[model samples]
Target chain A: MDADVEAARPWVAEASPTFITLIDQNHLLSSLYNMVNVPQAVWIDEQGRVVRPTETGGSIDILREFDPEAGAFKPEAMARAGAAKALYMEAVEDWARNGADSRFAYDPDAARQRVSRQTPETMLAHAKFQLGRHLASLGRVVEAEALFTECRELHPDSWNIFRETTEKMDTGIAAGEAFWGKVMGLGEKQYYASIDMDGMP
Target chain B: MTIVLTETSNSECVAAPSTTDLWLDADAVTAATGWTLKPEGFCKDDICVPTPADAENYVADGKVNVASFWRLMDRPAAASKDGDVWFLGEGATERNDALLSLEAPDFTLPDFSGKLHSLTDFRRQRVLLITWASW
Candidate 1:
């Protein structure tokens, strides 16, 4: 869910997907499902039990080969993210067609166990993020910046955390130098954690 | 006790009035914690958490005892020994408890047109709930 509801609306309006779209200005899903990044997916069954923990869900196939000379992202990075997206979409389709019988669907216990990996630090990070959003909404830039920075430091793996916070402060990916340096440091292959599609039924 | 406002992220520090108790007005509480005191309790957005019965006991001189409010929610906070400045950290007690049950916590939010929608409205339907932001 997007915290910047206003910004997300235009894209939603353009795509006009025939599905329920929701906004999460507080990023509650991040804490609820241990989602560290955007475009992540969580599978739920008809009975309302989560069948899959949050995982990277996106397709970067449309992205032309990463031209390092012309773009900030590396080719290998986009390739890895794309591969994960393809596999994730496949699993999603399997679940859609087969429901609970799908090999890709995890039982309640499995889902819980997978998401249980969230550490106390990560949980705190989530809180810091929500606080940051609240402060930002009130126009408390200095305070919000502190909390957002805390969130990123506490959960370095959560790129969305950094991206969201920095973008709000106008010091993120668009800022060029710092953003590119961090991205380069975190190689493209590791941009989105690789999806775990191996243990499917 | 003097409340020293220190920036945890960058180690910047500022000192506020020295006092024995950390009394924050309602507006200050909202700005610091994102939760506003409502008739239902401390609320943020569409979700409301009931304020503890002992909440009133913490109020004195028409200011809220932030430390006590934190205690009521079973959250932790740190304050300078002098009590002039306090830094409230993020509290996840409620969020963690809700997540432990694996049942989606219900909330309401307004759409682009300011129309409100609740999560429970879609009960029993296979929902592919997706969250995205412009950034």
Candidate 2:
């Protein structure tokens, strides 16, 4: 994607069209606008105010089912996507009808307030997840594994968090069981020693 | 309150209590950019200005020069180097001044495929920026 963007830059610049293409990598705009997932969009007016809440944007063709041989893919995911698409289409229609003065337009203050409600716990989980990724990148697998586990515990509903935690644990277990084995060994030792001591007593 | 002054080329660094009636470290500004520091103010991005003696200096230099600040903070300066340019300060957890209501730090980073993107890209369009990871 980076290469694609870079490759497209010259053409984008050469054309220098009236349309502007702004990129957001750190998700500052996403967070401020309360965007929760990819392909989501929020419309901002010329005055730097969010005219629309975060919603899925772009055209989407809803798929009701998939190839059965591909394994068990939940139908709920498709349902959710369909719902999201409907909401986004509605949002776009609203924007088209009203522009900046649309009835559905979001108040800047209200939008900010909504964003502020993104609980500290959510932010902490985000932080922990990031730290876990950082640690994993640095080869601190054990620490990263622990952090990812904590992140999942903190944000159980975050699919990415859960997936990452499971993946890290699986990889760690497969590549090196010493860490987990040591923990298990400690537990076993404590259990047997306690039982033996109790029996003697 | 102890004001830690760390001076470096391109900017002055000052760490003091936040005066915005909000939780924010005085170090956030300096850590973001390698500005020279003094009681009066700090300098960065070739902009030298004074800060409120009693107020938290969010950006003594109005424009955020992410590259310079990252170098000053001893963090990776380039997005390519760090994968993500904005790193939540390690000091945030420990410091009473850690920002709570402060706006998110401005940064540019690559997408999943390592594509560099900036906030300005989606400025005209309503953007639903979602931060998700493979976990």
DockQ scores of all models, one per candidate: 0.20, 0.13
Please give, as one word, the docking class of candidate 1: incorrect
Question: What's model 2's lDDT at A194?
Answer: 13
**Alpha carbon lDDT of residue B127, candidate 1?**
49
- TM-score for each of the candidates: 0.66, 0.44
Span of ten consecutive residues with least summed lDDT in model 1 chain B? B4-13
Runs in model 2 deviating more than 4 A are A1-41, A53-84, A93-98, A109-113, A168-201, B1-106, B111-115, B121-135
Docking class of 2: incorrect
Q: What TM-score does structure 2 among the candidates reach?
A: 0.44
- Candidate 2 on B1-135: residue-level lDDT in tens? 211111111222332222211112345445544444555544656655564343322333343333333333333221112233123322222121212222223346554345666555554554333332211
lDDT of each: 0.61, 0.40
Chain B TM-score list for all models? 0.49, 0.31
lDDT per residue as tens, model 2, A31-98:
23333333445455543355444443442322223344865445665665566556655655776666
**After TM-score superposition, what is the CA distance of residue A4 in candidate 2 from its true location, in Å?**
17
